[model samples]
Target: MKVNYDAQNDVLKISLSSTPVRNCDFDKPGVVLGYGSDGSLVDLEIREASRKIDNPRSVDLAMNGRSVHGVRLL
Candidate 1:
């Protein structure tokens, strides 16, 4: 999985699969869901992250109940 934030575009993307995106649909006004050719979810994108998120510049993620720094994870 990979996460990327484009400050210039104010977009935040969270990619869960490496599969090529074959289609995309807006789940909501500024939220888009990407799908692979197999119809599985590939990634998610949030537009205007600053307006939709409290702190667009900050990201705290945890996987498997643990964090990368071995500290608290949200």
Candidate 2:
């Protein structure tokens, strides 16, 4: 998995897999979803990320009630 923010483009991209994307869906405003040929999600992109998100450059991962990782400074 990968999360990236492009300041110049104001885009936040979260890539879940390296599999090739077969199609894309823009079902919501400022959002784009990528799906693989087998209908599995591959990636997601959020446009105008800075305006919509509080912080577009950092990530903190948690699972169940525990923190898997600390705040990651990207």
> Can you write out model 2's per-residue Cα lDDT over 11-64, one digit (the tens) per residue?
999999999999999989999999999999999999999999888877778778
TM-score for all models, in order of appearance: 0.80, 0.85
* Model 2: how far residue 19 lies from native, Å: 0.6
lDDT of 1 at 12: 82
Clashes of each: 0, 0
Candidate 1, which ten residues in sequence have the lowest lDDT sum?
65-74
Alpha-carbon deviation at 30 in model 1, angstroms: 0.3
Candidate 2 regions with alpha-carbon error over 4 angstroms: 63-65, 68-73
lDDT of each: 0.83, 0.89
What's the residue-level lDDT of 51 in candidate 1?
89
Model 2, global lDDT: 0.89
**Model 1 agreement with the true structure over 2-63: per-residue lDDT tens digits:** 77778889998989989999999975899999999999999999999878877666666678
